[model samples]
Target chain A: MKIGLFIPCYIDAFYPKTGIATLELLEKLGQEVEYPMDQTCCGQPMANSGCNRDAKETEALFIRNFSKYDVIVSPSGSCVHHIRDNFDAIEQTDEVRHVRKNTYELVEFIHDVLKVREFPWAEFPHKVGMHNSCATLRALRTASMSELGEPFFSKPKTLLSAVKGISFAAPKRPDECCGFGGTYSVTEEAVSARMGLDKVTDHHDAGAEYIVSADTSCMMHQQGCAERNGVPIRFIHIAEILNGARS
Target chain B: MSNKPVPHAKLAAEFLKDEPHRHFHDERLWDMRQKRDEQMHIMPEWQELREQASRLKEHTLAHLPQYLEQFEENARRNGIHVHWARDGAEHNRIVEKILRDHGHSSIIKSKSMITDECEMREYLEPKGISVTETDLGERIQQLDNQLPSHVVVPAVQKLTSDVAKTFAKYYNTDPNIDDPHALAEAQRNAARPVLLSGDTGMTGGNFLVAETGSFVVCTNEGNADLSANLPNLHIATLGIERLVPRMADLGVFIRLLSRSALGSPITQYTTHFRKPKKGGEMHVILVDNGRSERLGMDDFWTSLKCIRCGACMNTCPVYRRSGGQSYGSVYSGPIGAIIDPTFNAKKFSTLPFASTMNGSCTNVCPVKIDIHDQLYKWRRVLAERHEIPFVKREIMKMAGRLLAQPTMYRLAISGTEVALKTMPRFVLYNYLNPWGKHRELPHPVKETFHSWYKKNRLNKAKQHEETQA
Candidate 1:
């Protein structure tokens, strides 16, 4: 019943509403929650760039702040994936084991743990297309990606369908990357921008008024590209929509 | 312009400028990727085959030395000449020597990326040896004096009209014949005489069977068969990692290779050459060329298991848009991102950063190379060696510092919105900020979530404590 909220650095700094929405949604589902303010990030940017030494400091810090909670939840599947799957540099003590074992992304937590089919408080009246972040879809296994022959299911979509006045837009390459890719958006700027434009353009062509995703890092990247290129579409974090941001 | 040695980011940026061409290039490769998915779906055991192929490759790599020796001994007994090349220079020298010893002036080639990697044509052509690339795509690229943009479909980036012009220039055909079939026919007709008269033939093998001392070369066009069969002197080049333990094991790779390569049920010609024709010499050269050194790199050893099918390239969003030429390496796309960095960090350091680390390359790989994971690991290795671009490296270091201390991060970023709103776009979107060049920065939130949570949740907790007391 008690949960610790893990706000990834991007959500905390770039999009505070997402963190607030995550908190509100968890509370509305009748769970006791605590926000560990000392928790800054999951050390993915460092670890992914091959800077193990840099990642170790944050890795140890993450375990220190979130080790006590029976279950830790984050709005970003990628950050949770970084903590659970890629914290090899940190010593594998009991606390590290507990932190890695219990962390969950928001959709998976709601769909699998909360197991609540009804969301009486949630309402969104827009045609939205889902952008499956690589970390969330492929890394966290939050959904069945189009690549595999596995029976198709999406933890995020299941919850979205339960929300009132929401319709889904199905794009041609629905599962392709938005290409934010953390530092890649800047480092490989042109390809990254082209990828983001392609993804946002696809959703817009599919008639989505807004593109929604589980990872705000992707949302930020796609939204930025959409706005700059004058693409007539908006991006919303799944948490914001689930929290009834429109209201 | 020769795309002068530049970072992949810059090269990709320039490549994306031809917006219409880039979109055409993107859709052309994506269609292949979609077709590959169709093939993958038909086979219910596609995932199982990938696992089996990956495990087989891993076992072969782990026991590679023993397998190589067994292959050499068995190949020699089968009357196939075996050559060991320590590097690209050696591989090229050996190929030249074979042509010289056999008195061959013209050589015909079947789609061998290894030869491209060794720059064999560049080495051989200047010395009066005519090297003809028989694969239609490579031949088109060869005539145009261009490198292949995609390995499997070497000229896939080109349109039918582009090939029509290239054919007209080289073969004296009508440039007006823009139909795909007409252009292909012209190229094929021009190739027939060259295919028959060439005194030497060369190919890149898909798999080497150490058990039977046989090698398999799969191609849909049957060009490998023509080049391989017509010449009295035949040469097959392969990376040392191409060896498989047994001939029977070819089943798993064959099942995955064509389906993953072009989504074909099977290649038109899957030729197994255990022995050459009477009085003809068939030489199989095993080229190391940094592959042996890569096997020692624990973080990247699995990368050597690549089958050169180009499946990863087809599926890579970055590669599809940027084109393989942007990679500035023979290997491009996700596989190139991993393999290039392992060989020369200073030269290929930017390659690993080219990917978004989406892991789609990992899923589609028939050999299960775990390509995206390797890209991540390569980035870390580059930073350890201080090979990351200087400014980016320092920025990452600073980020690590700020991220470890939440209060400082909160203080620094919470009020970032005011700067975004007031700051001129030119100042923020200049050359210094790569993200700002073609994309806008995300508008910042009013305050950090920590500040909001403290005021809202922490205050409520305190009020509840007072009420309970």
Candidate 2:
């Protein structure tokens, strides 16, 4: 089966290691992965800002690029969520429907589709707090949220537990948002920063040396908050740890 | 209506400037959310109860007119005067006429958001009538001359010290008093006399039951009952959407209301008012006030199902960090973001954008209002109507054109590495960039993934193909 890797714009420019880790992790699991270089973005910034008309051409471009693959996977949960749910800018052709249906966030893809149990090469001895982006937590139904009193189940934790020597930090408010909402960080800068600071502080206070997540946008904002406030915590992508990064 | 958007972002920024207030507000509401979750944990049928309440509300909303007419008929037969108000002005007018006809010039009222929405006090104060808020938090807000920042806890945004000062100004209490109980005692002492001497009393209806022509008011303070019973004249105002087809449906709603609101199993007072007391007159004003028009709105009608439990406010991260007064509406937070625009679209346009669309409000809603989804829809509606700001619309359009073309998008963002290296942090991301005000920008990378892929993977694939050929 063909796998199309979707590296979002910020990931492509700033956090290339995360994109590299996702690709390498997929390949290490004996999957054929291809990064379509012409991909720019998923039009989330436009559509989220309530400009669906402006999002049309970008969404069309995305559909044109990813329609041929058996499944399209992205390292960012928010982008994948937009592709699956809110990518309604253009016409709903067969290609659009196909692209939307086959799109998956990398963690869910590995946890559900690949169903890989053990990462023999992956190990991290440091204590890290898991950050679930709102898209992954609520929109994607990835894990049992604290809001819904269902039996506790976490797909990301299920996949991460396979790694050896990894310790977890239990924060006070584990499932709260980190406030890296695309464009929301800039638009509502004060509250967004306050929330990000509060999130990293919670993890740090709970003895977490690092915060890990499947979505890099949240980590990027969180790292910014930590560094600015001298919070003394680090950030990493879940793909990096699952792909056996030792740091 | 004013076309200017409420300065939500600006006001929230100002609210954040007060570190003490911001932390207290966030932690206080977050504690309520935790308590709510604890309640959910005990009730195995919490989700099922929420579903039942949502279905009941939707059914009532679907046949709102018939239920309202039925309620009016039953209420009239029960010796209660039923009045219909098409708008806030008419509601205020009807209220004024009722008070004037009864020769009453003063009213001691409980916390009713509907009266606040109608600006009833603002309208009546000019005409020699007095309005006193009887609920403690609401009384503090009235004394301070500020809007109730929260739906359930009107003075939750104020610190205890702030309350002491406000009370000291009005009730001659000690400004140095730090105890909440003492403050409550002070308010009680001041309110008891006003309750007795007031010529009229007013209460807001929590649920209006059509089957028995009775309305329910749930309060922890029992102030609603005092406001309704102390005076010979009683006035209860409620939105028309509060109707339920039968008294049995109250079982579903009453169970969810306080549990979802304060995480308590039940309110201290759940008074049911069926008819007038002996020789006392009772008036029920069914206020439409744009609810019928909102009911016709396809994307927004479900917002009418809200029971004013304030669960959405407690769970909303944005509303917690940004004080509710920042919303500049009587109804604030997630519910307000959707409902306020129906009142005045241009005035509350920025309200829908105040959220991150995290969808927590939808989960915590007892009646299951799709609050975040409605907020998104409101944004699209506002933008379509040209209610959004000019610069934001233009920037989105520019971004759309640039991002659709891959080459152009690459060209636009490719300079960021150089810009990051040359520009100082403040110069690059400070005044011009709202992101730099409180957070550091991401560090510059030596090689972006695009360049690395082309250099390594693309070249390796070409080399393998050439060798094979």
Candidate 3:
């Protein structure tokens, strides 16, 4: 299958490795991959900020870049969700609808499309706790890291729990945002940092060595607080762990 | 203190600067969550009840005009005078007229976000009638002359020391001593005379049961009960969307509301006033104030299903940390983020952007309003109406172009990695990047998947095809 890679703008600019890993992982599963260079963003940052007016140009740009791909895959659940929810704005053309329908978050892409039963790489022995990214958990409806079930049917906690070396520690406030809500971090910095710190503390109190989640944006925020506060915990995106490359 | 409206970023910074207070507040919210979870675990049918309540709300909202008419008729039949207000100003004017007609210059009120929306105190005080908030938290905020920070907690943002200082200043006591209990005593002493002098009491309704022509008010502080019972003229202000089809619905609602809000099985008072006592007159003001228009919009109609449980608020990470003040509205957190826009989009356009769409609010909500989903919908609505910033619009346009194609996406990924690796950190930390303010950007990797995939998967697929050929 020819899979179009959707690299979210932030990942494109900063965390390109996530995009690269997503490409390699799909190929390792024997799926043909294509990169659409025109792809810049999922319009999430603008849309989430109550600036969909700003998203129009990006929405048009997204449609123009990835319209031809048979299957669209991105590492970020939040971005994929933005596309799924907002593609109608760009154009309700059947082609746009097809791209939106085919676009999948990496885990859902791997689990459902590829149906991989075993990790190709070896598993690490360390115990890892997972944080469910709000968009992926709520929007994409990814499996919960804390429970076991169908990945797409339940919250992302379930899906995170399925990864090897991953043991789920229930959040004190389950399913709460870690407060790294894109622009919210800057606009509401004090509250955002405090929320991120609270989530970090919760993970630390749970005796987690590493906090894994699907969204890099949230991990970035949580990891910053941990690093700044000299907290011992580490953060990794679920894609990095799921790719099993570190092992 | 500036005459200009306080930007959310500045407000958050001020809140964050008080590290000790933020810590205490977060800790208290966490404790509340623990208590709520424990309570939820005891009831196996809790999730079911949530579904039922949600369905009931959905049904009521779908046929809102009918239910509203039904509510008006029942309330009128019960000897309660009913009035409708088209908007905030109208609501305030109608309320003021009623108070004036009843010869009430002073009123005791429970916490009501509706009043907050209408700026009722600002309206009433200017008219020479004093409106005293009776809920402990509301009273505290009222005394301090600040908005209630959180919907349920109201005073969650204020530390006990802050409360003590405010009380000391008000009662002419020493500010040096900071004791919450003493401060509570002081407030109680100070408020008693005001309560006695109050002629009318007002409270926000939790649910206005259409069948009984009555409404239920829930509160932990017993303020609503006291304010209602003590005052000769009792008035309840409720949004038109607050109605339930039957009185039996209260059993489901009352059971879930407190548990979801604060983890209590029920609040200290869950008073249901169907009719006024013989000497007293009970009045119900069914305020539209933009709800009927919101009900007309399909995307946001679910927001009307909110029980105001504050479970969504309690579980909201943004709300828990930021407190309620940052949303710049009476409602804060997930539910507030969505609903606030419906009530006042221009004022609260930034609310939806205030948090990551963590599904916690949706999951924790007893009535299950799909708050995060509504936030997403509101983004589209806000965007369609040109509510978002200009810079964000251009960036999204650039992104939408790049994401739709596979080849460009690959080129962009490879190019971005090389740039980030060679570029200075400050370049990535520019003002345009919100993440740059507080987060370290993740380092890009050496090779992208396209290069690795072409070398591995495509080659292997070619070999398999060649073999087949």
lDDT for each candidate structure:
0.86, 0.92, 0.74
Question: CAPRI band of model 1?
Answer: medium
Put down candidate 1 lDDT per residue, B1-469, tens digits, no spaces: 2423347777778878887779888888888888899999899999999999999999999999999999999999999999999988899899889888878789899988888888888988899989999999999889888777777888877778888888888889898888988887887898899998999988899999999999999988889999999988899999999989998889999999989988888889889999989989899999999888999988899998898888899889989988888887777889988887655678888888888889999989998888888888887788888887777677767877887886787777755767777789888888888888878897866677888998998998899999999
User: In candidate 3, which residue ranges exceed 4 Å CA deviation?
Assistant: A1-74, A83-86, A90-99, A109-115, A145-174, A182-194, A235-247, B1-6, B398-433, B444-469
DockQ of each: 0.74, 0.85, 0.39
| Stretches of candidate 2 exceeding 4 Å from the true structure | B1-3
DockQ of 1: 0.74
RMSD of each: 2.3, 0.9, 4.3
Q: How do the candidates rank by TM-score, highest first? A: 2, 1, 3
Model 1 residue B39 distance off true place after TM-score fit, in angstroms: 1.3
lDDT of 2 by residue, B1-469 (tens): 3557799999999999998999999999999999899999999999999999899989999988888889989999999999999998999999899988988899999999999999999999899999999998888888888888988999999999999988888889999995999999999999999998999999998999998899999999988899999898999999998888999889888888888888899999999999999999999999999999999999999999999999999999999999989999999999999999999998999999999899999999999999999988888888889888899999999999998999988887888878987887669875888988899999999988988888889999999999999
Best-performing candidate as measured by TM-score = 2
- Deviation in Å, model 3, residue B150 alpha carbon: 1.6
Q: Better model by DockQ, 1 or 3?
A: 1
At residue A62, give the lDDT of candidate 2. Answer: 93
Q: Clashes in model 2: which pairs?
A: none
Tell me the spans in candidate 1 whose CA falls farther than 4 Å from its real position. Answer: B1-6, B463-469
Candidate 2 global CA lDDT score: 0.92
lDDT accuracy of residue A23 in candidate 2: 90
